[model samples]
Structures are given as C-alpha cells and as structure tokens.
Target: MNQRVLSGSDLAERARRAIPGGVNSGQRSIPGLTDLVITEADGARFRDADGREYVDYHAAFGPPLLGHNDPDVSAAVAEAGRTVDLCGVGVTTAEVELAEALVELVPSVEKVLLTSTGSEATFHALRVARAATGRRLVVKFQGCYHGWHDAVSLNVISAPERVGARDPISAGILPEVLEATLVLRFNDAEGVRAAFAEYGRDIAAVIVEPVPHNVGCLLPEREFLRTLRDECTRAGSVLIFDEVISGFRHDLGGWQAISGITPDLTTMGKAIANGYPVGALGGRADLMELFSSRPGGSVFFAGTYNGHPAVVAAALATLRKIRTEPVHEHVFRLGDRIRTGLSEVFAGLGLPAVVTGYGSVFVAYFMTGPARTYDDLLRNDASMFVGYRRRLLGHGVFELPLNLKRSHVSYAHTETDVDRLLEAAAAAARAQLADGDVLADVADASTMGGVADRC
Candidate 1:
C-alpha cells in the first residue's frame, strides 16, 4: 500500500462533504480566509499543511495566551497521558487543585466547578443564578458573547436592522428563552437601570464580558459596570462576569481583579489551559453549592468529560507558569506595542481608524472615533475591515478576516514580530485604502475552501 500525501485544498474538500459549511464553528468559515490546514504550531507562529509559515496573531481566537504549543503546557499534557485518562464517577486531583487555584486567584470565586467548554460554563452559571434566585430573566449586553447557549447566542455582531431588537442569533430557540433574556447595549448604564426598574425581581442574572472582546474589544465603562453591580445587588439578581476571553489572559485574578468590581459569579475558559479545552465557573460557596452533587443540592450539573486528566494537567501547568513567570508583563508590553504600532500606522497614512484593547489583545477598527458600544462599532466599514485583514495574510500574518475581530499578542511574540506586523500593515493599508475596492482585490486565502487545521 502506498501512502497518500494530501494538499491543504484536498483536505478542505474532504471536510466540506462531511462538516457543515466545511467548518465546525461559524466564525471559521471566512469568505476569503478559510482553507488552511495547520500542520504545526509553536511559539508565536504556525505552519500550514503545505509548510507555509505565518506569525500567528490569531492565537486560536485568544486561547493561546502563552502562545501555541507552549512547552510547559505540552509537557504537562504528555505526563498526564502516562498517568490518568477518564473516570467520570469521581473527580480528579488535578481538578481539585485547579479549583483551589481559581478560588485563591479570582477575586469573586470562593468555590469552583470544572467544565469542558466556555459554553457549558456559562450555561451552568445561568442555571445556578435562576435556581438560586428563582427568577426567569437574564440581562445580556448586545456585543458581548458568553457562549452559544440559547439565552446568549443572540445580538452579537448583529446586522444593523437587528440592533436594539430582541434578535436571536440562531433560530429554534424557544421563544420564551429569548423573552427571558433582556438585550442591552454594552456600556449602557441607563439601559441596565431601566431593565431593573421594569423587571428587577424577575431578572436572575446580568451577564457581561467585563471587556466586550467578541466585537473587537469594547472596553467597559467603569460607571456602567458599577451600575450593574448596584442594580443587581439591590434586585438580588446575580451578576455574572463571563470572563471566558478576558479571564486568565488579562490577569491571574481575571478582569475582576483589575476592574475592582466583583461579580456574584464568574465563568472562565480560553487561556486557562494555554489552549487546552477546559472551563470553570466559580463564585460564592453558598451559590455554587446549589449543584446537584453538593449538600442541599438541586440544580443539575454533569459532564462526562469534565475535568479530563490531560486538560486538567494543562490548566495546572498554565496557572503555575503564570504565577512564577513574567507571562503577563511580557505579553502586556507586546500588546501595547501592537496597538500603538497599528495606531501609528493608520495615523501616519491619514486613515481614520480606532485601535482599542486591554492587555494582550488589540483590535484595529476601520472607523473614526472609539468603540464603547455595539452602536459605535456599526459605524466601522465592515468591507474594509475584512479586506485589510485579508491583505495581511499575504504578508504572512495570520489574522482572521471576520469583521470586529481582535488580534492577540503572546509571550512568544517579539518586538521584531511587532515591527514586521507594522510593516505589513502599512503596505496592506496603503494598497487597500487606495484601491477602495469592496474587498474585491484582497488576496485569496489558502488554496483550499473548507476548514482550517488550527491545532
């Protein structure tokens, strides 16, 4: 028998026949940036199946905080493979150790529960809130994305027509579930107040992404977050900070540490495991005890793969490195470099754009002024956003071309990498802005048409 070496395009074609839209996640099916089959990832770069290398600012949508294939995390996972696999009945020691760390580090987490994905963490958090308070309503900001759960999978990156309306991002969700969720604008303190005034007693939780990273980083207004705390406290509604993206990426304590505002519950994932699949929900011990497995329990919370040994080991290693090493200091410096560099690039070219983000995350918006809400981001040129990102791929920088998406910086990146990105950005912006095409001239993505092998 002869071995078959498949091209990236050939693999993508094979996937399209099997997977919906040739991708597992909707965001991966980019119009001009799909078809890459990643063969390897290490440090700050990734290589496509065909061996084309690119500096990876995509960072697997902000999961690779320590950078792709971090040595510490990889080694831990390898060791775990030799030790334990899965025993669903009992919890793993690694899980207990991770929970202890979460409680110690995250300001609001007195106790914690492990899960396999961000979505599951969020779903469980909302359930806890509803069960604890006996309320039916959940208040979610428009631009923030907690997860794909029915209550949240709406209004994110919504079309202009759907703004300010109860628009479900997906159909088939029970109408009552949509009604239970009150959609409000990010940084809209008045909206929070009004919602509380109308349905305070019925609202179970006010879920937010302290920094709305999903729509390219709409930094939260301190007053708005404070207002949420005050309203939720007065109404006895649980305040849930969905820190899936901003959790371990920002600080060991999550954004709650830097913000100086505590939530009743916190959901964390993404960088917690340095790209390993693990999520955690943590909060006051009194509330977390509502899980079916606990004393005086009622709410059901179970996952067959929760706290799988290898991923738990990865999380433990990632946390230990964050505690002992200069991970945050390094990545923060690089984040500032990229954001400032991008700002300078656009300003020098006399282009109107806004660059915004907190530590280790940056988004270059193709519009004038700042973006603190979904409404402000709508002013951005969606076409130019996609086209500029597409052009950068030609320069060997991997940024997903989806509009309102942010680029990440990791400890693996260097000042030289920032310089290269700026140089690439200058060239891409000059050509893209001058041509003024509706992304018509953007370079083609990989030679394939389906899924990207992002490992």
Candidate 2:
C-alpha cells in the first residue's frame, strides 16, 4: 500500500482550506491530524499517511462489519457499477431484492425506504411517526444522537451542569425545534411514564436506541423497553428504534430482536451496506403507508441516491455474507475476549476503569461505576480515557480518541488483533497511572473549546 506523500499535518492544512473543520465528518476531526491520514485498509489494519501500520478498532467508525474492501462486496459493487451509473427515480431489481431480503430477515419490518445516510433515514422516520400518529411532540433520550437534523439533534448530550434540564448542544437550531422535542434520561422508566402522562396526547413518537450505543454502549433495562412499547401503544404514540450503530452487529435482526418488543418505525445504518453510504427506514405497514405519496398523506421523502445500485449491491452482498459466513458469532466471542482482557488489564494496574459493551461494540469508561446515563458518563474520568486512546495509537492500536464512546471489533479482527489491543491498552493504562494526575485535573473543564493537541 502507498501512503500519502504529504505528512498528516500538511494534508490536514490543505484539506481545511478545501473542506469544513479540516475533515469530512465531526468524528474524523481528532485533536490533531498531524499523525493520522488513512490511505488504505485491508482486513483489520489501516495504513496511515506516514505509512504506519495500525491494528484498527476504528473500523471506519462502525460500518466495516465485514472488513474494509471485502472481496464479495467490492466485486458486487463493481459488477453493479458496470451495469448502471444511477438507478435514479425508477425502480430496479437490486432495490427490490435488498428490500425483500431485509423484510425476510428483520421480523418487525414489513417495508423498507432507502436513503444515502443515517440522517435521512431518521429524518424520514420522524416524519412518518408524526403523520401516522397525528401528534406534534417527539421524545428522545439525552446523549443518544440520531443525526444532525434539527428534530433529532436537540440536547443530544447536555453538559454536566445541564444534567436534569434540557439544553441544545448546537446553535442555529430553532427554539421551536428544541421545544417540539422532549429530552429525557436514558434507561429511566419513570421518566418515560411521567412524560407520557403529561404529553401523551401530543406525542407523535418515542425514538430510542434499543441498546443505546452513542453514549458509551449503554444497555437498556428489559422492563424499560417493554414500558416504551406498552406506553406508546396506550398513548397512541409511535415507537421508533434507532439501530444505526447496533444493526446487524449483534444479531442479524438488530437489538430489537433481542429485546422482544416491536416498534412502529425502525431506522438502520452503519453496518447495513458494509461501509457504503446507505441507510434504511422501515417497520409497520400502516405507518409506512403514510409515505405512499398518494393523494391523501403529504409525508414526501426523496433522495437523489436513495436506492443506488452500487450501494444496494454492496448491501445485498454484505447481508449474504453475514448469513452464509456467520461472522456475528465469531465477533461476539472476540468481543467477550477483548472486554475481559481490558477488565483484567485495568484491574492489574489498580485503575477504576471498566470495559462495557454488547456484541462487537464496546467502550472503556475511566469511571469507578457503570455508565447507565449521560450523567454517569459526565462523572466518569473522560480525560483519562481519551489519554488512553492517544497512548494506544502510539502503540499501534487505533480506537476512537473519545472516552465513553463507541469502540468496534470488526469481522476482520483476529485473535492476534485482540491480543495486540489488550497489550496496547495495558500499556496505555500504565502510562496514565504513572502521570499521577486524574483526567479531570489534567483536562480543561469547559465543553466548547477544542480538545488538547495529542497524537
């Protein structure tokens, strides 16, 4: 593999002038780009701009469940690209096949609507929910991000000071958009019930991540999921499960399958198309009917690349690979191995860190206790965990630099890859402990400023 000729910093400087924030996405902009510029990836490793080889846990930010440049998907995409440049507005055989496959595999979804990104799927889901229920308010949990859309982006992660109160994280989001959305605590049944009691009549939908991975892979209580289903039904509020990060990572059907509760609407992305830019929204027939574009309902949804043949081909191939090869079981076993290794490594160092996750995704929280809610995450030593991310990169393991956020273990990761991660993690922990200062002391307390220069 060939590395970029320019250093990471020089490349970033060049990119910043051409692109926003010196990166294409928010997560791609780490503290500094001086050391990282990905050129090529194969199996579990990525070659940086400097041609440094790294065992990658980034996994293209959680879409490469089948690994980067998977032969099956690449071949499928290539064949499809040769057949058609763009499907455009017309129907295609590939789109129908992909939708049919999704309907057959995912128990709750009867129909599917495709989009170019996770944001579009979520945005459409909210529109469907509002149209179906004829209500105005939408409920979401704090710290669980659906997308950058105005409706889904409100108070995604309130700072520690705004723990119990609602506060929008971004500016230019209309006050009306924030008011229309009701932000609540994650994993709280009482809060759900109380909100329903107060705003049930006006509530259009309750969208929740079945496993809540955006805030450090927080697991939902079984009863809480049941409560969401029952309460939404009783109150005539549509239930939506946002499975952007969890879809096909654990079970092929997603977290909702393990929860045993059906939602009115479901949004899926990330792992759906094996790293291609695609997403899907689907569920009950009655609610999906509102999107028919017939005379009556006005929930118009359209995208230029909604059912792109190249992306659809990739998705079909990825789904087929998951079914035939059955990578989920292997990834689960490997996930357990890595989690246990991190736990043991932290325990040996006498650090109060915990490795928590489900399926192939996990997070290392530098707190004494579990992170059940955003408040719990705020109390955790985020600075220390981020420092660990930086040190691990120096040792050739590339996980996200943010602490208490999503970490990945892809199908390409071997037992040796897990060993390398645990080794780097142990070393990172030792480095943090030797510094003697807690992450809270070492880090700036403000939320608006940029992260310190690292890596």
Taking all chains together, each candidate's TM-score versus the true structure is: 0.95, 0.94
Q: After superposition, how far is residue 345 of candidate 1 from its true place, in Å?
A: 0.7
Tens-place lDDT per residue, model 2, 69-170, is 899999999999899878466688999999998898777799888998888888899988888778899999987778878887755556677766666656
Per-prediction count of colliding residue pairs? 0, 1
Give per-residue lDDT, candidate 1, residue 341: 89
Q: Residues 259-373, candidate 1, lDDT per residue (tens digit)?
A: 9999999999989998988888999989999998685599998888889999899999999998999999999998888898899999999989999889899999888986878
Where does candidate 2 stray beyond 4 Å?
1-4, 292-297, 436-455
Error of 2 at 183 (Å): 1.0
